[model samples]
Target chain A: MEFLLLTEKCIWFGLGAAGFAVLFNVPPKTLIYIAFMGAMGGFLKAILMHFDETNVIISTLCGATLIGFLSIYFAHKTHCPPPVLAIPACIPMIPGKFAYKMMIGLVNLSGNIDHDTYTQIMSETVNNGLKVVFILMSIAGGVGIPLLITRKESSKGMRLRKRS
Target chain B: MIAPSPKNKEIKDLGNVLLNVGAMLLSSGASTGRTRNTISRISDSFGYSSDLLISHRTIMLTISDKKNDYFFNNLKRSAPHGVNFKLLSGISRLSWQVVEEGLSVNQINVQLSRLAALKHYPRWFTLLFVGLAGVSFCRLSDGDALDMVTVFTATVCGLFIRQEVHKMKFNPYICIFCGAFTASLIAGGGLKYGMGFIHEQALATSVLFLIPGVPLINSFSDMIDGNLNNAIVRGLNGFIISFAIGMGLLTSMLIYRF
Candidate 1:
């Protein structure tokens, strides 16, 4: 039931994304891909959030990498920018709320902290920070791979053709 | 490549402009250094002339002898109509290919003067305004009508102030801060007025403002074109822009308590 509910929510979000893309003058197909990627990214993030007992950063990294790769493949196939898909897709993975909470927590944290409180707060902050960075890195990696491949291929082609 | 006919020149020039704007937008929003590099590389591969690339540092392009007559003639025609040739030239350089071929410096200067006279805002302004609106909409979603209005008003005011300050050559950081501060005031007012829905709508709309559409497009184009560095750079820039907007909003909220 929860999975169904999540899937439904993702579809709605995807639709919203598609609408926005069209409204903004982007190609409809591009928007659809973005929406689909976003939904999947969100679902993966949610799954990680629910079942993963590992560090938040690790979980986020794993989830983002998985989603990002899928987004890249889709983007390549569609001849659209991966970030078009990845950025929206990663929207759900964004630690906006977590970052906000962390900011609030830090601001409210008294100077005096016993070991347990200090440890917990420190751990949480570190976890949230790492999660954000990890997610960002994942996005970078997803976009980077194709670019690198293309560059290598083109340069090699140029060199070989020059020799021939 | 076709021989440079008059019409061909115009078409090529237009293509260069589109490509340049697209590249810059992509580079600006990229999330990694690699993406920015990739865009530059891809742009080179696309055969953008060096002048377009160089003017990224200085907002000036040297006119070329080959294109001089054409550029000036067009400038003279546009000038009588209060159009600035320099601005057009600057805008023209948005593509490296056009820049490489050379353009009319004097005409472009005239265009800039005209543009200055017209007081046209930078393209980034529209983007910033739209982005703020999206953020405000998101915040207003908590169900506050007055809050929504306040955020809307504040965002507009903030954008106005930002434009004015930018005209005065204020620091970029200062401009961002002012924009965010004004947005916060609007958000707070919306909260005070009980316009949560308005705020939510603004926030939702604003999210699109930060949408790295250009960079994403550029990255994809670069990747497809086999220019990885350019693509990577564009992607990284997109991330930074998004992060900056998010941070600005967060800061505003923290300061305003709404």
Candidate 2:
């Protein structure tokens, strides 16, 4: 069951990413490559997180950095920009449940409530909201690594390279 | 009447080309740095120095010729931001062509039109696959077979509503609000009624396709690149959209008490 869960994580995340790519109108040929990258990143995160010792933020950062670097190679093969491939593939890593919980806490806290209840709700909201923020930052920070190093599009220097 | 000199006309033309490219890139999802770089590359290739002021929805460009001592300024209001990777990639390539070929302004304009006219993947394809994405998201959250069906149903309905509302020229926020409301209505109902063991997971992931993931990442990337103003504007935009989606979900939850 544990192994199955890990493997399915990869497949489902890949499908999710491919769906996202379609929504963004990525060219048809690139979808497979984007799915492959998404799967690899999702699997890496799943494995790291399953160990139960590593922090979620660290695991997410590693997954996203892997996606970021992979995007360069995949983007080269697909003939698209790196972000075009990387961003959508990273979407599955978003903190959806945390965001949902924070919103709910906010809504409940706004109504008339006792002091203890208010404190409890506030704590929950802060915890969930902070998680969402850090996870988002990690995703951005991790994926940004490749983008920073690449500087210019891979296609930019292809002609110059051939000439030289 | 003295005719304007050819050099003067050329500088004006260059300014127009720069505005068009900047507007297209900014609106079509290029980051601030890329848009600035592409504009500078094109202008430099044309022997003009360029400077740009890029805001949330407008680009102000200045072009100057050093020896001729000519400076021209142009401003254009960019279209609303949307995720279209094809346009982003297309314009990047076009920028390279401008530099490599020394293409005339008219030729670049022709190429821009061609790229703009390029068709997206079929609408039904996006709609169906987006729902599949929702299903995949549901599964990732540990949803079961029954929950997958529930999410698929909710997502297709939600996305269809969004597209329909968007096509009618409704504000994009309103479109997202409506989509979120529809998806959560169905998923919330499933959660309330216990449609499956994983129905809660379905409910959570159902409206997630509406999250502005691109804008969020773009904002972070912009901040890292030191475009602080653009970053703040984009970050705020992402937050507001998330809040709107949350409000829609809240409304559903209130109705269903889930």
> Which is the leading candidate under DockQ?
2
- Residue A163 C-alpha lDDT in model 2: 50
Residues A5-55 of candidate 2: C-alpha lDDT, one tens digit per residue? 888889998999999999988877889988998899999999999996448
Give Cα distance to truth, residue B133, candidate 2, Å.
Answer: 0.8
Residue by residue across B105-171, what tens digits does model 2's lDDT show? 9999999999889899888889899999999988877778989999999999999999899999988
lDDT of 2: 0.87
- What TM value does the first chain of each candidate achieve? 0.62, 0.92
- Per-residue lDDT value at A60 in model 1: 55
* Alpha carbon lDDT at B99, candidate 2: 73
DockQ of each: 0.08, 0.75
In candidate 1, position B19 carries an lDDT of 39
Q: After superposition, how far is residue A75 of candidate 1 from its true place, in Å?
A: 4.5
Instruction: Tell me candidate 1's TM-score on chain B.
Output: 0.45
Off by over 4 Å in 1: A12-29, A53-78, A81-85, A109-120, A146-164, B1-175, B182-258
Question: What does candidate 1 score on TM?
Answer: 0.49
